[model samples]
Target: MGGSDSRCLRCGSTKSREVRIFDDPQSLSEAVAASNMPKEIADELEKRISSYNLRLQKPHSAESHSSQHVAAMMDATGDDGQLTLSSLSRSLERMDIHGTTAEKLIGQAEFEGRLIREGQDTWSWLQQSS
Candidate 1:
């Protein structure tokens, strides 16, 4: 089975030559659905397929996620127009953003004039009312 023609004889050639049978039932079901093989892998494949299809149907974005981070931080800001590093850090945590990425985003925000550096460890959101 070293040649390019090598494939699972029982599984048939309906699936691409790159797919493989997985041990986990969920993964196996996904593979079976994408394969040219018969639909008799299991009854659970239907549920898995539906779940997969639902995930595929959701909206996906390639836009700036950092904007959300900035927005979250800005929302957490007080009425005095003060944004502390610790406060921003907490905001990032609430937004599920990692530390390094959050820091880079903060730097980017400052560089882009979205945020203004006030002190060594503090920042201020350049609030735009529009």
Candidate 2:
């Protein structure tokens, strides 16, 4: 059982060697569905992924601080009226939001039409028409 060719101790099966990067729940779910991992592990992972996706899809509540953070970011657009992903992450960090929480807030903002994607990692504030 070498480093690259390790085998599962319980079942004597060769472990998968492929490395996958999943940026979203759909991709993760797809990978889990296509994997040859044990049924128990794959089922657990699928359950957790479904729960995570549900959480992300839920609407932000009125008193939710996440909504406030998004509003603040929208109001703090740069001089060029643009917001970079890095900048948004940094701002969210300052507000004690990091990792997946920050990501969810950013996604929510975009989905709510508060931020319009302008490039791969840049967005512009979607100003409300009077």
Using lDDT, give the best candidate's number. 2
TM-score of each: 0.45, 0.43
Give the TM-score (vs. native) of candidate 2.
0.43
Candidates in order: C-alpha RMSD to true structure: 13.2, 16.8
**Candidate 2 residue runs with Cα over 4 Å from true position:** 1-64, 98-100
**Clash count, one per candidate:** 2, 0
Model 2 residue 49 lDDT score: 100
> Model 1, 58-129: lDDT tens per residue?
534324554577676786676888777777777778877653555676688788888888888777878767
Where is the poorest 10-residue window by lDDT in model 1?
58-67
Global Cα lDDT for candidate 2: 0.72
By TM-score, the best candidate is 1
Note the Cα lDDT for every prediction shown.
Answer: 0.70, 0.72
Model 2 clash pairs are: none
Model 2 lDDT at residue 28: 93
- lDDT of each residue in 7-73, candidate 2, tens digit only: 7778988856666788999989977766758889878988999999888766654357666676657
lDDT of 2 at 73: 76
